[model samples]
Target: MKKIISIYILLSFSFAYPVTLNELIDLAEKNSPVLKEKALDIKIKEVKKKQIHKKKFGEIHLFGSFNRFEDPRILYPITPPIDPRNLVGAKNQFITGISYSVPIFTGFEIEKNTEISILAKRVKEIEYLLTKNQLIYNIKSIYLKILSLQKQKKALISYKQSLIELYKNIQESVKVGKKPEVDLLKVDYQIESVEAEIEKVKNSIYALKSALKTIIGKKDINLSVIEDVRLTELDNFNRTQLLKNINSLDTLKQATLSEEISEKKVKIAQGKYLPKIYFTASAQRNMGNSEYKDLWQVGFIVEYTFFDFGRRKHEYIQSKLELKKAKLQKKTLRLKIIQKIDEALSEIKTAISKIKASEKQLLFAKEVEKIEKAKYEEGVSDLYDYLLAKSQRFLAESSYYQAIYEKESAISYLQYILEEFKNE
Candidate 1:
């Protein structure tokens, strides 16, 4: 019976429990409408690539036409019949046919188009990954912020409890004519102030959680986020290796794909200077009042536009300019990515220093508060000193939690910049 009850309790906890950062990110990816849209874009690009590929094989069409003439004419070309009655002529005729046209050559236009489509698909895939990475980063940052707030709230509650005890002690001292009634009132005011701050923190937490729900596409606003201390531990990345691996980032990959696509466009434009060749074949039956004739033909066609008022030349130049622009953009993006990496690393270090400083400050504040508490109770100090010490302690505790979470947030951002969340 005890085992069954334990299983039931575990099941209940599994159904509704604090989700870890990774679990939240997974939920956001699975439910986020933005991610869904990006996923659909990938599929659309895939279909587009296939469409461009099929174009190389050409198209087949079924065509029908009707015509009326003022004078009777032969429905189709035929040998003259010996009997005049056997001649097939009509004022109205109908022809129905199926025709196939395939591009034999367009100076590599088809090949270039196929290549562009492939590059486009790759770009879409990278874009999807970029979107997912961004979502994960957002979830991590918000989760850290929420955890920080909760810790601050807990510290505030502790502060309030201490104040309440001090208030009761001062009340008794005032009754015994050892302390002023104003001391009790002062502690009362401080308690009220701390309570207000706690309420503010509560509201802020609610707002952050609401935002989290929106991002994760969840209807439940009562979300409990778990803090994994391991996430705060930084990995020592080789700065040189990180710099060298920047090219593998999704942003750079996207830019590179764009440049390649532009190059393909330039090639396609250059192809326009050459003649286009096609293979055509058709089979048809012409129907008249008295006869029906079947006809079929196969042929190759070559079309050359030697002069188009320099249109092809202008297009080729334009494509070349675009390719140059793409190259410039890629260079700019590379520099920016490097700058961002530097900034994130610097932030991580700064947060680490702050965490250390705040940790020491909190320890000092706790000792000062304890000393002041004893002094105030023994009449060695006044209420003001005790209140100040408690306030300082609360601030130090809040700062410590803030610094810790800030480091976590910075690390999450660095991981995002590095595309570390792509696989997840």
Candidate 2:
């Protein structure tokens, strides 16, 4: 049993060192599955753009055909002064050729499509940044919470020790008949309660560390302990400055790209209403049992859809509506961004106020606990009053820490909304 206890103690301390915040953030970036997926999306958009651009160069084909006719005929068309000898005929015929066909005109559809693909790629890039910003924000928030909980655990441990000392003193008093037996029981109960609270804090810390491990993609990394996080103060911002810079936000940029893509779709629909022109060139060798001929031709083909069952018109209308919808979405996102920034700023102010209030509360609670401790020692106060004062002090300390971390969290959220991680 002693050996088992020794091994347990060794194992517990092995992973007790704190991992730095920057190191964790870097690990998350390097190993995040979601970020990798977004990167692949950008590459796909790039390939799509290339594919559309390649269409402008047209395509070439090598074609062949064989046939056995019912009757003898000329191997291929021949133009002459009706020379019967030269017009040889055969039943078996074969033709092989190379043809090149290119679109001479399609109302600029290829160009518009290429533009849309470029915009889509840009949108993907913006999405990647947005994902990264949110991810970092989440990591920071969790890290701060863990630090806060760790501090609370320390306070709880200290509180428990004080209670234990009081329980011992009360036991001595009860033996001497200087205090009632119930006072000893009361102190013992307070100690038990503090122990329970300490266990609760330990369980919370374990759960948070497990979640942090998943986020960084290093489930095996030792996060059994974490150091306190220090928050860097952010610069002040007013409505005017934030609004002026809102145009550069990634969400808005993605919306703009969507609007542009929709506009291109409308143009593509309009292109369908116009005539299409194609240029074709081919060279072929025609063979028969007794005749061999070589022919080459170059021509232009014009195709116009003079009628459709209002399909083109309906598509054009749909595209227009989609474009309108995208515009409205962009407008909505802009308003949301403004509102979020305002709310974040207000939260920061509220947190600062709480921090100040909690600081004073903690100071007063400490004084009260000190006075109660002295009075209890002098037999002028009851155990209940002393324990209550200590509990109040512990709670005040917890609240102060909570307020500070909340302010930091609010600042992190504001930075995420502004997409400030790009600069980092």
lDDT by residue for model 2 (1-424), tens: 9999999999889756778888888988988777788889999999999999999999999999999999997987878677888787889999999999999999879989999999989999989888888778888889988888888999999999988887788788889888899987787888888899999999998998888878777788877666667666663667689789999888898998899899999999999998999999999999999568999999999999988999999999999999999999999999999999999998888888999999999999999999998998888987788889999999999999889898988888888889987545
For model 2, the local distance difference test gives 0.88
- What lDDT is obtained when candidate 1 is compared to the true structure? 0.88
Off by over 4 Å in 2: 1-17, 88-92, 233-236, 288-292
Q: Find the 10 residues in a row with the least total lDDT in model 1.
A: 221-230
Clash number by candidate, in order: 0, 0
Give the per-residue Cα lDDT of candidate 1 at 199: 100
* Residue pairs of candidate 2 with colliding backbone atoms: none
Score every model by TM-score: 0.90, 0.91
Q: How close is candidate 1 to the true structure, as a TM-score?
A: 0.90
lDDT at 323 for candidate 2? 93
Prediction 2 TM-score vs. true: 0.91
The positional error of residue 342 in candidate 2, measured at the CA in angstroms, is 1.1
